[model samples]
Target: MAAVTDAAGNPWFSWDYVQSNASALLAALIQHVELTAASVLIAAVLAIPLGILAYRVSWLTGPILALSSVLYTIPSLGLFAVLAPFLGLYASTVVIGLVLYALLVIVRNTLTGLNQVPVEIRDAARGMGYGKLGLLTRIELPLSLPSIMTGLRIATVSTVAMVTVGSVVGGYGGFGELILEGFRNNFYKAQIMTATIATVLLALVFDLVLALLGRLATPWSRRRAS
Candidate 1:
């Protein structure tokens, strides 16, 4: 009575299909969230320090950004292909690729935020007897919170999209597997549309969550704007 029913005359969607595949959909969605969150977090952890180092050491900025730029230019499929032999066909390969891809934006944004801190502010902090480490921890970082959060939000959304490409490697692609399955299974209308819709929705939801987190983290930004 289910599976595929053209007799209902609507091929674009199927309530029966969604209801039948609910568990699979939930599993895929969970995997998608895990992949996106892990990649963005790892990227942020690495990028922030690298950004700080580059900002501190004037000579390193070119090389650091250049490397991220190179990583960014590599195609997602190509990056996965490169990592497959080392990481194999697992989530790790996808995660490493995502982390690399996320670096450019996050690192650039971090550096930008640090640079945006006025020179006079640094001098003022120094006048208040704050050392370099203390000044950065107490002043520069807090002021740069908005920019860093913006980069994280952007990286998170992009990572969510890139995660679908991982389906090419394995089940690690989350909802991506559903999309691929739909394509392979004679263009299963409900599966294809459902997975596609879910992907877009997931990205939107992640963006909204990050936006909220960013606002909460940078209450000063709101007050300044007001």
Candidate 2:
């Protein structure tokens, strides 16, 4: 392939490069989606219970939130390096790191939403003979759906962006790999632009889908707004 350059002598964008790497791009896109989904779901499972416990035990809340906040602050590359010794360069390292990163958002939002439920509402439920389980499942959870969905939306979008960084873990395929490859082969500006655009588009699409799902789950919120 002849190198195409602009008048400024920089490599110009080429659709041919994107066409040539279409299969790799598709594979990377699928892997990226899978990694994001798995990490978020796993984080939710672990975080929701911790969130509930934190909300119930006032003393524990500070420590729990602190730990998750610290985890979130860890640099992504540094976290991957730390995990590599134990988990190697496998996708699991990426997924586990991402899950930890997601915990702060999920747990904080869960607690916030649950705690926001009015004390009067809880008392009213009890007055009507609602048991502890009934109060949680029927009342608190429903009212907190909006907050939980917001957390999920945030987590999902962030995870999608982060998954690209996982390409550094070796054997991991994501748009990040394409970006790195383009940088390594500086002539391939098309590769860099394609990956960058695709990553942003992926984040936007997932965020919108999650927002729509949030709306569906909390129809009462929409009704109230209208």
Q: Locate the minimum summed-lDDT window of 10 residues in model 1.
A: 1-10
Identify the leading candidate in terms of lDDT.
Answer: 1
Question: lDDT by residue for model 2 over 1-226, one digit each (tens)?
Answer: 5446677755555667778888989988988888999999999999988988898789999999999999999999998888888888898899999999999999999999999999999999999999988998999989988998889889999998899888778857588888888888954677887888899999999999989998988899999999
Query: In order, how many clashes per candidate?
Result: 0, 0
**Candidate 1's residue-wise lDDT over 1-226, tens digit each?**
4444477654667778889899999999999999999999999999999999999999999999999999999998988877888779988888999999999999999999999999999999999999989999999999988889889989998898899999988889989999999989988878988898899999999999989988998888899899
Q: List the residue pairs that clash in candidate 2.
A: none
- Count: clashes, candidate 1: 0
Give candidate 2's whole-model lDDT. Answer: 0.88
Q: Give me the runs in candidate 2 sitting further than 4 Å from their true place.
A: 1-12
- Residue 55 in candidate 2 has what lDDT? 82
Candidate 1, which segments miss by more than 4 Å at Cα?
A: 1-10
